[model samples]
Target: MVVQTESFVMLSIVLFVLGAMGVLLRRNAIMVFMSIELMLNAANLALVAFARYWGNETGQLFVFFVITVAAAEVAVGLALIVAIFRSKRSINIDELHEMKG
Candidate 1:
């Protein structure tokens, strides 16, 4: 059981790293946002796994908080994305640079 839990955590960590890499390397805004969500989900998975392995409820509570925050973030982010799309007609991260000034 311990070995299985450890392997699950390792896999989740690898997936989180890949998602981080995708967020860093992708130029598309939507893809980057999706990658960020993927990373969050991966962490949630790890937390739940650890909670089950250790027989603790704290990890589950933490996962709940994470999910709440992720939901709020996605809502606000998508709204902003829509506004940007309406103004610029493009979802590319590079195009957003012009808005800095």
Candidate 2:
């Protein structure tokens, strides 16, 4: 069973758009961070689809690097979120901006 590249690309686009909406519409810092991760995953999906269609290993290799970076991003992002929540007792972005010095 062969899947078409267009299908994967379309799914990626939909996921990316949903992620963008989540980032824009949600006021919670954690939600925005999750949406950003979703966007990254969508891009990774597109990259893998293109690599498979082109019969090349480059995109797959690039995905490994992306995943590595994403892992680091997750660690740092979650740590920040935890710290913010501890200090503010809230993860609302609007409330965070009031902390401007």
Per-residue accuracy of model 1 over 19-54 as CA lDDT, tens digit each: 999899999888999999999989988999999999
**What's the alpha carbon RMSD for model 1?**
1.8
Question: Which residue pairs of candidate 1 clash?
Answer: none
* Deviating ranges (above 4 Å) for candidate 2: 99-101
Tens digit per residue, CA lDDT, model 2, 1-101: 29999999999999999999999999988899999999989999999999999999999998898899999999999999899889989889888666566
> Each prediction's Cα RMSD?
1.8, 2.0
| TM-score of decoy 1 | 0.89
Question: Pairs clashing in candidate 2?
Answer: none
TM-score of each: 0.89, 0.90
Model 2 is weakest, by summed lDDT over 10 consecutive residues, at 92-101
